[model samples]
Target: MPNIEQFTPTEAYEALREDETAALVDVRSRAEWTFVGLPDLAELGRDTILAEWRQFPGMTPNPSFLDDMTRQMGGTTPQTVLFICRSGARSQDAAIAVSQLMEEAGTPIRCINVAEGFEGDLDGSGKRGGLNGWKAANLPWKQS
Candidate 1:
C-alpha cells in the first residue's frame, strides 16, 4: 500500500553511506540483538536504530514502534528509512507499515527493506548466519 522498496544488504549499506539523512532500523528482538549480533555502523559515524518490531518471549507486535522510531530519530524530518529483521519478512512488514503511516501523515518518507535481512534465510544445513544476510553479505557487525 505504500512505496516501500526492497534493497540488498549491500545496496542499503551503500545508500546509508551516501545519504546523510538515511536511517537504518533493526526491527529485531532484544534477545536476537544480544545473542545473534547487530550491524556496526560505527565506522560510518552512524548508529542503527534498534527498534523491536515485536516484543520478546511472546513475539507480540510492539505498540510503540513508531514512537520508538521517532525517539531514535530525535524528531528529525522523514527521510530514507531502512528496516531489517531476521529473515526479512518482519522488516518488510515493518517497512510497509511505516511507509503507509508516513504517507498518511504527508511526509512520504522513503521506506526500504533489507530483503535478505540480517541473518538471512536458512541454509541447507538449517542454519542462518551462513546464509545470504547482512552478516553473510560481509557487512560490518558487532556482537552485543
Candidate 2:
C-alpha cells in the first residue's frame, strides 16, 4: 500500500513499454495463464513474469510467493512492476506482499496492481474478459 500503484490494464502496459526496467508480473495461476491466455509483451522484447499468487487445483495461497517472485525477477526489483491476476483482488494483495519482500531485501519497488486484471469484471451473464480487463482492452495476448 505504501509504494504500490494501481493502474488500468492499458496504463500498466504503457508504463512497462516506456520503462525499460519495468516488468509485468502476472500473478494469476499457471492454469489461468495456460488455459485462459496471458498478455503478450513480445513487442517490448520482454515477457510477462509468471508469479502466481495462488496455487491451482487447491487454490491455496503460495507461501513461497514472495521468495519465488524475487528469484523469478532476478533479485533486483524493477522500477515499476505490475501484478495482475484474474481479478484485481489478488494482484492488489500481491503488490502489498511483494512490496514487503522488496523492502526487506533493500530493493525498493514500485509495485502496481492492474485493477481490471486479465479476465476483467463479470458481464451480465457472469462471463469474464468482456466488460473490462486486459483482454477487453484488446492488448496483445496469446494462448499457451
Q: What lDDT score belongs to each candidate, Candidate 1 first?
A: 0.91, 0.87
Query: Can you write out model 2's per-residue Cα lDDT over 45-142, one digit (the tens) per residue?
Result: 98888887889978899988877776877876677788999879999998898788777878777888999999999999989989999999999999
Q: After superposition, how far is residue 137 of candidate 2 from its true place, in Å?
A: 0.3
Candidate 1, residues 65-136, lDDT tens digits: the string is: 999988989977457899999989999999999988888888888899999999999999999988799999
- Candidate 2 backbone collisions, by pair: none
Residue-pair clashes per prediction, in order, are 0, 0
Best by TM-score: 1
Off by over 4 Å in 2: 1-3
Please, what's the RMSD in Å of model 2? 1.4
Question: Candidate 1: TM-score?
Answer: 0.97
For model 2, the local distance difference test gives 0.87
